[model samples]
Target: MVRSILIFVITYALFLISGFLFQIDQSWYDALNKPAWTPAGGTIGMIWSILFACIAASITIIDRKAGGLNNLKPAFWIILIVNYLSNQLFSFFQFSQKNLGLATIDCAIVAISAIILTVFALNIRKIAGILLVPYVLWTSFATFLSFMFYSMNL
Candidate 1:
């Protein structure tokens, strides 16, 4: 039980660290042409917090179900880590570098990774897969938004 809690805490911490490291330049972002449907700044943060919590919970469940990370297949670890990193990279591309094209591509990869992770999680536990649905949906929407931003800004 303690180990599961540690996994959740660690995963959540990594997400928070990633966010802290790659922050948006609000002034620059405000200048960009965004869709009417784009979420407000506070809403984006709230959404991410909820999504990150879900991710942590999912990871904890998976770790517990699989009897720890060591027992799981290497592919599972690869998918999880890759998904996390790619998701973070979207922020780097969009906010840090202000490269909409690369951000769009990053979002597309994140969306795909979410789907892959969800499918893999389903094989392990149903709830684990279900938890990833929001992440997948959000990334898909972000991909579309990124593409729109790229098209309009270019």
Candidate 2:
């Protein structure tokens, strides 16, 4: 149980590093012509926090079921790393670079890779895959939001 808790904390912290590194440009973001349905910054942040927890849980489940992280297949590691990198890149593209188009593309990659990761996870552990459902749904929503931002700003 202690090991599982450690895994969750470490994974979640890794996910959050992107947010810390590439914070939202509040002034510029606030000036954008966002859709009426756009969520508040606080709401988005909360949602991400929840989603990251889910992701961490999913990883921990997979790691436990596979005996250990090192025991997991190379393919699983590849997909997981790809998803993590793409997910982190979204903040850089959207906030740091202030490139909505790149952000939109990055979101699409995040969504697609998340689906792949979930599927791969299901093959290893059903509960692990199930834990990722919210992450998948949220990333899909975020992809649409990114596209909206791109189009609205352009």
Candidate 3:
């Protein structure tokens, strides 16, 4: 019980770190020309937080189902870590250098991670599958936004 809670908390913290890394909300991002439909920062944050919660729950459920970390879903775990690191890299690198090209790819990976997690969640746990829905949808939106950002900035 405690472990599960810890896992969720740690995972959420990792996501929070990714969000703030390299000062992603800095002036440069604000200065960039964005689509008229781009969401405000508060909305983006709220959406991301909800998505991250889903992801954390999914991870907890899936990991628990996989023989309590013994026969553990190695692939699922790896992909999740990759997804988190990619997200952090995107936020940090894209903001620091304003690298939209990489951000585009990074955002795609985020969506891909959500998809992978969703599929694995279906096999491992239903709660897990449901948990990733928000991430998949939201990250898909983020991917589209990233492409627009790249197109406009370039």
Candidate 4:
């Protein structure tokens, strides 16, 4: 139980670090012609926070089932890292660089990675896998949102 808590903390910390490193350019983002369905900035942050909490909880469950982080398959780590990086890249491309095309591509990768993570987790632990459903759904929606941004702005 202690180990699971530790893993959750570490996982969440990494998420925070990624967010800090990929700080959004609010001024540039505000200039974009966003879709009507786009959530407010605060709502976006709240959604991400909820999603990250879900991810951290799911990771803890997986860590417990796998006997430890070290015991998990290499593929799990690879997918997790790829998903995190792809997610960060979406923010970087969309807000920092203001490149909707590249951002859309990054978001697509993120959605794909989320699906991969869910399938891989299911193979490891049923409940752990189930926990990723929300992540997958959210990423799918985000991918659509990114596509809309790209299409509307271009």
Candidate 5:
């Protein structure tokens, strides 16, 4: 159980660290002709960092209760992977070369992945379900932001 949680924490830490490696300057982002309502990069980063932490903690609790890796459900693994990957990919789409279209699609994917992960997490642990609440909410908000960005930019 503790082992399972450990894995989630470690993976999440790496995910975060990887993000920090890419330096997206605020000035650069601002210089780009963004839509009127796009959030400041720091604000978005902080929110995502917090949400990712919560998700890490939530899955850890579930992992502990589930009696370690073998007992952990496949859906749990898949959704987590998808969520993490989508999160990582969005940075690429949003920051690298500034592709609003790809960013919108990736953000939507993250939102859907959150929904699926939340559902699967619920089946494994109620706390896990509750844990995903912030993630789900933010992702939904991001979807709107992305959609708006796409519409405005395109």
Candidate 6:
């Protein structure tokens, strides 16, 4: 139980670090020609918060279902870490570097890695996989948004 809580906190914190480390340039982002369907800032934040929480929960569940963190397969760890790194890179590419094209590609990686992670989680536990659905969906949506941002700005 204690381990699960620790895992949840650690995972969520790691995911949240991108926001802190690569602060978004509001002026630049706001000036972009966004689609009418683009989510407002508050809505985007809320969605991310919820998605992060779900991702943390999914990881925790997978860890438990596999018997323990150490028992998790190396392949799972590789995919999970890759997904996390790709996720963090989005903030750097989109905000810090202001490279929408790179951000769009990174988002696609995040979405694809997330789908792979979900499949791995499903092999361990159904609920764990289910928990990641929103993360997968949101990342896929964000990928589209990133592409739109790139094309519109170009």
How high is the lDDT of residue 138 in model 6? Answer: 94
Ranking of models by TM-score: 6, 2, 1, 4, 3, 5
Worst 10-residue lDDT window for candidate 5 reads 17-26
The whole-model lDDT of each prediction reads 0.89, 0.93, 0.82, 0.85, 0.79, 0.94
> Per lDDT, what order, best first?
6, 2, 1, 4, 3, 5
Q: What TM-score do all the candidates reach, one by one?
A: 0.96, 0.97, 0.91, 0.93, 0.85, 0.98
Candidate 6 lDDT: 0.94
Better of 1 and 2 by TM-score: 2
Q: Between candidates 1 and 2, name the one with more favorable lDDT.
A: 2
Q: How many angstroms is residue 135 displaced in model 3 relative to the true structure, after the best TM-score fit?
A: 0.3
lDDT tens readout by residue for model 6, 77-98:
9999999999999999999999
Candidate 1 segments exceeding 4 Å error: none
lDDT of 3 by residue, 46-104 (tens): 98888778878877776688756556657977987778888777786578767899988
Worst 10 residues of 4 by lDDT: 13-22
Q: Residue 134 of model 4: what lDDT?
A: 87
RMSD (CA, angstroms), candidate 4: 1.3
lDDT of 5 by residue, 9-40 (tens): 78578668647755566676666665677787
Please give the lDDT score at residue 23 for candidate 3. Answer: 73
lDDT of 6 at 67: 82
Summarize candidate 4's per-residue lDDT along 1-154 as a digit string, tens digits.
7888888888877776656767777787787778888999899888888888888988998888878879987888999999988987877787677788998999999999999999998998888888889889988998899888888788
Q: Of models 4 and 6, which has the larger TM-score?
A: 6
In angstroms, give how far residue 29 of model 2 lies from its true place: 0.3
Per-residue lDDT of candidate 2, residues 65-126 (tens digit): 98899998888899889999999999999999999999999999999999999999888899
**Model 6, stretches more than 4 Å misplaced?**
none
